[model samples]
Target chain A: MGARQTLGAVTDSDSSKAKRATARGRLLPANQEFAVFATVAVCFVAMALTMPSFLTLGNMFALTRGISVLGILALGMGIVVIARGIDLSQVAVLASTCGITVVLLNNGIPAPVALGAGLFIAIGIGCLNGLLIAFVEIPALFATLATGLLTLGATRALVLPQLIVYLGPENAWLQQFGGNLSIGLPIPVIVFAVVALVMHVFLVHTVLGRSIYAQGDNPETAWLTGMPVRPMIVTEYALSSAIGYIGGLVMVASTSLMHLQIADSSLIFDVILVVVLGGISLTGGRGGVSSVIAGTLLIGILLNGMTLLNLDTQTQNIIRGAVLLAAIVVDSLLHPHDEETSKQGL
Target chain B: MGINLSKRLPAIAAGAALSILAGSAMTLAANITRDTSRQAFDTAISGKKVAWVPLWMGVLESEWTGIMKDQFGQYGISLVTRDPNFNNDAQLQAVSQLIDEKPDVLIVQNNSTTLLAKELKRASDAGIYVVQMNMASNYVGDAYVGVDYTQAGHQVADELIKQCGGGKTSGEVALILGEATAAPSIEGLKAITDGLKKDPTVKIVSSQPGDWDANKANQIATTVLQQYPKLCAIHGFWGPMAAGAAQAVKNAGRQGDVKVFAISDGQMGDCDLVEQGLFTKALSNRADVQGITLVNAVLSLLQGKDKPGDKHLFYFTNNYWIESAKDRGYCYKVDKAK
Candidate 1:
């Protein structure tokens, strides 16, 4: 009887999949990755037309360098969002971990050890977020939000206590991560690109990756099929936090200071905006690596263009909001509501 | 889950209690040593508690705190700080909580001119001497110390007039403010613009709030540059954010063309940027001096024979323009090894 029910569901899914395939063919027929490719292309053209300096090597490099940290964080957020969860504490965890690392480094601890310990603490925070959301059954949003606050507060109390930790001249290796590598490419840009590629492979080609989709698609179904749903959730959050820590390291490297203030900025919201704009349905089970890249590129292009145009922050915010809203509208039209989609929180 | 919850609750409660106790102890100690003389303050405030509540302890605020922590520690004043982290409600609540704990002197860095005015008034009214730092409030409490922002702004404007307001360069200038509503930034920008009336050649091409964000400043600088290529100078209200404008200029291949100037709380980061020629000029309100001044103001209020309403003391620190490598006195580089 269980087998028959499973088979029936599979058949239903198969038919829906067929319909989706047909729809995708009609709408995005030429390129399988048309959504991401088209968005990047459009952003490039728009920026180049609006700002003459937008296409210059110097400006382009700066834009890429600026977005590297954002891209890294968004990559983590994308993974968590794809797994039918969200980690708002990523930035806060990053800040706390990075702040601690700086303090440790300042105290004469080796760079590698400090970096490792920081990453570990970040992962631990992610696990805490996971434990709360998965075991306690708290909503991912509230759990991560609460954790973010806790981590930031705790770090401020225990570490520098309202101080900015400036990495000295001795921490040259760490600085190099943010500084330039080759002729014009920043180390952070390279790191981001590499991380993106790794995440792409992990999300697309691995069994764990498939499980993430399964968990996102239908938690109940995934559990029924013998998948460890709670553990999967933990893994996803852990991965997000780990990536977020690296992003924090990149931020500190680029800026030469570990500022606890970064966590308080509207950065997490921007991460979520990038993820959603990339067509990662808040309903989950739909978006993947391509979505994050697409979203990051769109935001990067918009920001780069705005910078090149020398638009004020307020106007840039307006343009960004409008673009995000437009993206949401497009996403909604493309992916209509379904019962399975209801399981993932929008 | 139940066990974890029980464990976490106690840990959180303990942390809260410890912080409160530490906060109270610092205030009580500072109050206890109120009778100490000016010559004795360097020793009297030693080991005493001085709790600080800032709107948010950013790079600028932290530098002031760092100087205080070091100087006060050497003198025997224990500094306990509560960072509201830019939340107005949180700041108010922290102040109320800190006041209840009765710190010797509650030093507050107000977000707006008015957000903390009522609470600050209440603190002084409750016999807790309040030291308002850098930013002022309508309350005009026991002691007000820090930069004369209006004066600083006027100075910057006067300097700009010398540079661009004359017939020397295209007088097209831009103003990058920290926050639109922030009293200091707003007043400073106003003063500069008002001061510009002395010369008709200066045209304020773009004046926008960057929210004290470097990235935002970069974007603003870029746009303003594109709009007015002959822009002579961009005056930023904060140092780090001004660095963004400088970066934007560099990125635009107009580093030498457009000049970037800003006012900062003498942080090494700001000074370093200036020394690197990322900024044309930086008006640094020496944070270490301000920190010492804040300690002195609090000590005076605590020990002074004057009652609460008698005479509200105000100390204005001098601002120095860091124009070249030779003018880096405003900043103190913190060497952790020391």
Candidate 2:
């Protein structure tokens, strides 16, 4: 009887050990990004195999260039969301500043000075958003929404009453940013790549970056642990605004103008969609530049393909909204939050 | 007896003088009546009130407002304008309120065909004369003064066919619409589709909506260009929006190869773009002329001769094709003060 009991105990211990090993593997395996990246790859391969025109150099370049601006904005939004915040005003900030830049340039201001003024305004608005959310105890969602309306309204009233500013002929140098590089790649795509690399390094290697994650994970705990959680929140939003300005520049470069009407369009929602669709959980504290790139790529490919297929806007929007809903559902299932993990302010 | 004779002689002299004066006065009155109809003119035109509700006060609508205000003011009529700023609900509210105020004329530019249909019917039933501009609604108002977009579309497509139709080019064409459901856009698309059917060689490779956005046009046009490098011509619904597609073609270094056509509100910006060779050919409906037409329609309706909704009058203004620098006059200049 003792021998039999010993054998049974050994078997039980072995089974428990195997179970623990598998659980650890599940915890640390290729993350949500891997799944998204895989999906992108599969779509790309399928598109290339089926659509004869999809593999062409011109089409490939166009696809990348089209997505470059969206990718950049998604990256910025991802950073803010990683720190458990949202930015509904990113597009408004971008449109207003870009309009100001063009209006200044058209008035004979030098391109460099005009560009600086635009970036400065964008960052200022972003910091203002941060101040409202962090210092005034306002929710990011409501604060950013109000800030966006205020920014657009003020810009429209004070500067671009016409709401559309076209780049002048003298601004060829400014327009080059939207053009091609010597290597036959779009400059915007190159800009997007460089921005992504820098962001990846900043998030993965820096102390402040880790703090953003911790703060997003549990802001109260992070504050108790001596992190300057408030300042970190400000920095996150400021960065988002600054990067959104870059995306605006790309947009202006590509189109040779800026239409402030975009402030009221679905662009901000699209940015958020791409960010979250790539597995950037809105509940906060997860996702990086890779997730943004994956999201951008998937969206880019889908849009490019749909355009090729000549689908109408309504059909396209329906598919896009469905995909976003599915992504949100999947995110909730994968990153289940208990009562303790929910942010205090939320 | 001597007194009576003297009195009679004085009376006869006075009678002759009175006859001469009365004859001259009658002749003068007859001439004046033959030359002028002052009372009728005053009753028809002077001291009227007109209320205009536009979709928004953009360059085009503002131009219309400036023209209307100036002309109506000159006619001794009071004009009130409410700018809805592209919000349909606000437009509906403005129309309803203006109807209640009971202005002699209520002119509206509908954002959609049905959004203001009920309100317009209410205005007409309330004995208010209604004028619809640029876009018409299902409830036809008293008078409609705008471009016949279907004809404009045919003009644009015909121009495209001239450049890209029978063996002149690769025959691959694309169309960019402003909005899918907008009456102007839908009628224009249908007309272009029908017009393109005339030339079997020309094949429409892609037809998409830009949603009246320049950037969206640029993006879609860029992708279409990539898919069809040998694309012969591209047509867009509006000039300002089509300018983006032109920019795309220019960016692709295919500006000279691709002929771009559009029916645009002939704003100065459209002229500038055409002069810069961004657009190949533009069928411009002179907004300035259309604005004048709107004022004239108001004048005709307010002659106090017709009941509300009694006259279904339409003033289909002509469209001009802007092809070269010399055709710049076809596009109207927007006043800065407006």
Q: Who wins the lDDT comparison?
A: 2
Per-residue lDDT of candidate 2, residues B88-169 (tens digit): 8899999989998999899999889999999899989999999999899999999999999888878877777778888878
**Clash pairs for candidate 2:** none
Pick out the ten consecutive residues of candidate 2 chain B with the lowest summed lDDT: B1-10
Which number leads on TM-score? Answer: 2
Off by over 4 Å in 2: A1-30, A344-346, B1-47
Error of 2 at B22 (Å): 34
Residue A162 lDDT, candidate 1, scale 0-100: 50
Model 2 - which docking category? Answer: acceptable
The model with the greatest DockQ is 2
The estimated TM-scores of all candidates read: 0.75, 0.88
DockQ score of each predicted structure, in the order shown: 0.16, 0.41
